[model samples]
Target: MIAIIDYGAGNLFSVKNALTYLGLPYQITNDLEEIRRADSYILPGVGAFPFAMKMLRQTNLIEEIKKQVVEKPLLGICLGMQMLFEESYEFERCSGLSLIPGKVDRWDAGGLKIPHMGWNQLSVKQPENPLLKGLQEGDSVYFVHSYMAYPKPEHLAAFCEYGVQVPALVSKGNVYGAQFHPEKSGEVGLQILRNFGGLTK
Candidate 1:
């Protein structure tokens, strides 16, 4: 079973619904035991960084999450992806899960529209990545965010150009992140989730 973390963030329903539609078994919970017992875990979020981290702390799931991602396949979406980094400059100051070596900051483009919301193509940097196996370059994915992660080039799995080359997909060992909401990206997105679901150990 796949565990969809519920830390009081938005987009849980869509993630769950997508899994259901795909005929994939899953559970939505904040319980650490449930998280650890699951075959795989998905961290889905859409909201402020600091507040989301606060919720995780309130539920006492931070360490549990770190444990799971370090030893198992864990997928993070959007803000959930941002939370995997070491720190974020979203609001005043906030620390993340530090699962990956990077920092989250708002887009630095001078006049480009903030919260790059729309369909953008992904440029596969590491073609052999299981998450990007069947996906190709120029495949459009939906994105809706102001802040983006800045992991080193070696950690980036795929990227998308929007004024600048943004880290759209990143993975290190068993941990993976997608800046775009695959649940909202139609067929391509569903395929990505299906691919992730198939990565269970």
Candidate 2:
């Protein structure tokens, strides 16, 4: 079963709805033992980096998450993806889950609006990653964020241009992420989640 970790900070309903629509059975909980034994896991969140980190630490799922990702498939979305990185330069220079080798940085804006919302096309880089299984370059997806991950180029599965190239899709071993909300990005988004759901270690 897939575990949609409820760390008290996740935007659970939509992700749950997405999973249900795809006929994927999942559990939303922070129980350590359940997390340890789940076949797959989804870390979904919609919030600030520092606060999200605080919530994850308070729930004490940090270590369990670390352990789970090493052995099973783990997918992080939006803020959850940001959390998988080493650190984020958002709000404060806070540390992340350290699962991926990268740092989150604020978008340069460059005369464009902040929190680059609305639809944007993904400039796919590492299209061979399983999380991007059925996707093609230039496919549009929704985005709503002010900061983006700046991981190593190889870790970046795809990018989207705003004022700059934003890390839209990322994967490192068993861990994957969608900077955009896969649950809300229409069919394209759902397809991304479906791709993640089918990934196996």
Which candidate number maximizes lDDT?
1
Off by over 4 Å in 1: none
Error of 1 at 33 (Å): 1.8
lDDT of 1 by residue, 1-201 (tens): 999988898589999999999999999998878887988888988889998988888989888777777678889999999988999999767999998899999776667888899999999999988898678789999999999999998899999988788999999999999999999999889989999989887
Encode model 2's per-residue lDDT on 65-139: one tens digit a residue: 888788798989999999999999888899999999989988676999998899999997886777777787888
Q: Deviation in angstroms for 77 in model 2?
A: 0.5
Which pairs of residues collide in model 1? none
List where candidate 2 sits over 4 angstroms from the true fold.
none
**RMSD versus native structure for model 1:** 1.0
- C-alpha lDDT of all candidate models, in order: 0.90, 0.88
